[model samples]
Target: MTTLFISDLHLSPNTQDITACFVQFMRNEAIHADALYVLGDLFEFWIGDEDRSEFALLIKNEFKTLVASGVPCFFTQGNRDFLVGQRFAKYTGVQLLGDETVIDIYGRKAVVLHGDTLCTQDTQYLEFRAKVHQPWLQWVFNKIPMFIKKKIVAKVQSGIRDEKEMKSLDIMDVTPSEVIRVMEAHQVDLMIHGHTHRPDVHTFEINNHPMTRIVLGDWYQQGSVLVVNDSNYDLQTRPFFNQSI
Candidate 1:
């Protein structure tokens, strides 16, 4: 059996086509996998676990179905969906992972994360991430009514879009030094993550040891999946086609 990984779906009410693609993936591909790991941005934005919108319920049902079929699923919160809490996990039966986690891949150790923290040059985003990840701030934000929270999220997203346009590509991408540091710190040769949206396999040396970094692509144009087993791994992209769901 092969372990599957995906990230940056950014599923939302506006992207019904992408959502359908994801639903099909869950039903057809994920059910047969050994395990599934969703790296981040499962949703465009997750306001709170209390979100019971139709879109949220649809995604939850898909995860529930996948888990019920005997395949284990895991999730790591992305910059957009960091508010996903225990309530969401309970509903979906998906285990939530920490920002940085290490696991055995077939036999070798591999580190998995959402990958935003590796962009050390993006000081603005890093600062914002620090502020938003505060437990006290999240507790207060969660107490707000859903309607108000939605407005706040919209305003924040708008600001983010404007800021992103002003930033350079290099600033937004992960720092090579940071990547080497993280891999060395974790003592892992393989690292998998999604956030940069630049999907490709990167090879280099860390203290004379070979290292591999796999970046998962966003699901804006196509569905991206990484299939891994004992022998090797394949990164694939599935185009969205018009099909009855």
Candidate 2:
């Protein structure tokens, strides 16, 4: 059996093609896999479980169907969808994973995460993340009216987009030191994550131990996936147009 990994779909009403693609993936690809791992950014923005859109319900039902087929779905919260909680998990039948989770991929121990913490050079973003991720702040935000929450998220997203335009690419990408530290702390040679939207595999040695990092790409213009089985792993993508039903 094989396991599939995907991230950064950013699914939303505007991205209907990607949503269709994801449903196709669930039906044709995920059903055949041993497990499915969504690293992060599964949605453009998830305000809260109570603010479910029609599109959100559609996706949730699809996830429920997939799980009912006996394929387990595992989700790690992303910067955009950190509010995913027990209600969402119950509806989708997905197991919520911490940002940093370790699992055995076959016989190899692999560390999986959303990967935002590795961008240490993005101090501004990191500072904001620290505050937003605090339990007290999240609790307060969750208590706000849904409409107000929507406005807040929209404004923050817009600001982030504008801010990103002024930042250097190097500042946004993962820091080498942080990556090494995380991998070593997890005691794993293979690390998988998504956030920066740069999909690639890097092989290096850390503390004399060979290590591999696999980055998952965003599903903006295309679909990206990583499939791992007993003997090999493959990274592949399909165009959004081709993905449409």
Whole-model Cα lDDT of every candidate shown, in order: 0.94, 0.91
Q: lDDT tens string, model 2, 99-154?
A: 79999999999999999989999999889988888999888998999899989989
Would you estimate the TM-scores of all the predictions? 0.98, 0.96
User: What digit string (tens of lDDT, one per residue) describes model 1 on residues 124-183?
Assistant: 999999999999999999999999999999999999899999999999999999998888
Q: Model 2: residues >4 Å from true position, as ranges? A: 242-245
Error of 1 at 228 (Å): 0.7
Q: Model 1 Cα displacement at 40 (Å)?
A: 0.6
**What local lDDT does model 2 show for residue 12?**
86
What TM-score does prediction 1 earn?
Answer: 0.98
Which of the numbered candidates is closest to the native, going by highest lDDT? 1
Write down the TM-score for model 2. 0.96
